[model samples]
Target: MSDAERQRRIAEAAYHKARERGFQGDRHLDDWLEAERELDRQEPRRP
Candidate 1:
């Protein structure tokens, strides 16, 4: 997928993660990074 699409997916994943935790403390960055790692593992970038 394109960079924009990838970013959108990550953002959506992060949002869901945050929502899952009741949108508690300031963990946006952690959620985003976790999303990125999950996505990357699912589909690694091309060389």
Candidate 2:
């Protein structure tokens, strides 16, 4: 996918993660990183 698409996916994943935890605390960075890792593991990007 393109850069924009990849970012969009990551954003969506992170949002879901926050929702899962009831939107408590300040874990936005953690959620975003976790989401990126999850997506990368699912399908590694090629350079």
Candidate 3:
């Protein structure tokens, strides 16, 4: 996927994660990073 699509997926995942925790506190950036890591883990690395 393109960078924009990857970012969109990460944002969506982060939003769901935040919602799952009741949307409290200031963890949006953390959520996004974690989501990106999770997505990265699911895909094979490109050389």
Candidate 4:
């Protein structure tokens, strides 16, 4: 998958996991999601 797609899936998974654990604030979820995306963006992809 492309970087954007990979990041999106990772963020979505994390968001759902947090929600399942009772994370209710939009700000917290958004911040976590953005952090995941940023981390993925910084990583080098393997061929």
| Ranking according to lDDT, highest score first | 1, 2, 3, 4
Better of 1 and 3 by TM-score: 1
Task: Give, for candidate 2, the lowest lDDT window spanning 10 residues.
Answer: 1-10
Instruction: List runs of model 2 lying over 4 Å from the truth.
Output: none
* Model 1 bad stretches (over 4 Å): none
TM-score, one value per model = 0.96, 0.96, 0.88, 0.52
Tens-digit lDDT string for candidate 2 (1-47): 89999999999999999999999999999999999999999989989
lDDT of 2 at 45: 100
Query: lDDT by residue for model 1 over 1-47, one digit each (tens)?
Result: 89999999999999999999999999999999999999999999876
CA lDDT, every prediction? 0.98, 0.98, 0.91, 0.69
Could you tell me which 10 consecutive residues in candidate 1 have the lowest summed lDDT? 38-47
Better of 3 and 4 by TM-score: 3
Candidate 3: stretches off by over 4 Å: 45-47
Encode model 4's per-residue lDDT on 5-29: one tens digit a residue.
8767767767776677688665666
Model 4: weakest 10-residue lDDT segment is: 24-33
Model 2 clash pairs are: none
lDDT of 3 by residue, 1-47 (tens): 77788889999999999999999999999999999999999974465
